[model samples]
Target: MKFAKYGSITLITFVLVAGIAIPLSPSPQNWLQFPVIPGLEEKARNILYHVPVAWTTVVAFLVSTYYGFRYLKTRDIDYDIKSVSAAGLGFLFCFLATVTGALWAKFNWGSFWNWDPRETSIFVLLLIYGAYFALRSALETEEKRATLSAVYSMIAGITVPFFIFVMPRIMTGLHPGAKEVADPAAISKAQAIADSAIAVGSKTFADSALATVAQMNVGSAVPVVQLKMSPNMLVIFLLGLLGFTLLFIWLLNVRVRLARMEYERSTHHE
Candidate 1:
């Protein structure tokens, strides 16, 4: 287990750098052919890193909640400790994701804070988990703390999907997959760009494609920018996802061990 944890960490680090360092396209100027998203351009590189971190946060929270549920059923202190450790790491990853996302927003949206639906939802999620720690801290007895924390984690789990995925998609936001974006016209436009970018190799194809979209005097107030990643981009994205997932697993293992040690020491002193 130890070898797997540390060995994977070294391998993942190399893979992550490779994903980030490799240019989006074989031809730098013709990045449009390689999954350089229409509006995002160079900024799309963040997608490789930012998205995986967000996903890891979700996985961590889910694991935390599962352990919390187990603790409730078994009344085991170890399960409670494991739950807290997972949650603590989850919150850390969530904060990192938010920070990276905000930086991306600063470049993409021209502001550090935009109150975008996705951003708002993530903030609310932070508060929900933040309250989890606060509630744990307030309790004096072990049983009370464990029971209430487990209950709160279970409740928070229910809101995870709603906040992270559902609510953001329901309301029109900068995120993809919104109501307006799902329209037929947007899909066709995205397909056209992809087909053109692949068939014709030149900067002009991208410029003309974007120009056509701009000229289309759309009826909607908000512009619909579809994200179409190329095959090369998809490969990098998958590598990043794999690396981040392994990193999360390694970190979670280390964190749980440390938490167990701390719990043992505290109880020993008491």
Candidate 2:
């Protein structure tokens, strides 16, 4: 927990400093600058924050599922505390992801909401988790609430991967990793740059750091989504991913402790 606390702050500070201060150039002369990927340009810096937050959202939800399973197996109220705390954190991060994505979309595509495949999927996820909280509140019995939501959490968690990873890829709509990129030629030069970077021993830092920034189609009035990143961006992106993940851990721990304190206070009164 202590490591998560200090490490997150340190890494996130580096990400922010490097992500913002580093200049974007059409032709980066050295490692100090980032080559401007076509179409994205300066706007691509948003990835340092937005993508990591969305990644944390997925992690929180999965952690909630794990604790929910533990509660089911052990019938321990503490596990329930952990499960619900994680769910709350997941919901918070999910909303943050949605807001940040919408803001990016507004700048890139001329609208706040395009219902892009990934956008649509994330919206549905919000609704699903929102319903989970509603169901928990409707029940007064602690045991029943925990048991029912544990089952619900597991079921909801099962669909998360499908919504986030599988469905987006299988569809023909926007977002990278999809079957089609919508406009390839417009980004051919950028893709070539990215490929060459990878060929020179650089790797796609994170296959899914929580997707963001889709390549715009040159031919269409509307837009499609894809990514073309330089190695410089990848370095900060990786740091951001790790920082946000550790931040989630610290937050989850604090939330669980607070919940337990509240539960203990109530138990003492009753």
Worst 10 residues of 2 by lDDT: 205-214
Q: Global lDDT of each model? A: 0.72, 0.77
Q: Which stretches of candidate 2 lie over 4 Å from their true place?
A: 181-226
lDDT of 1 by residue, 70-162 (tens): 999999999998888889988998999999999886555444664557788678768878999999999999989999999998887777677
Task: Report the lDDT tens digits of candidate 2 across residue range 1-270.
Answer: 999999999999999999999998888888899887544568788889989998888888888889989999999999999999989988999999999999876554444675667888779878878998999999999999999999998887777778767876655454555545444543443344444444554343111111222333343433344466778788889989999999999999999999999999999999
Measured against the true structure, the TM-scores of the candidates, in listed sequence, are 0.78, 0.82
Model 1 residue 20 CA deviation in Å: 3.1
**Model 1 steric clash total:** 0
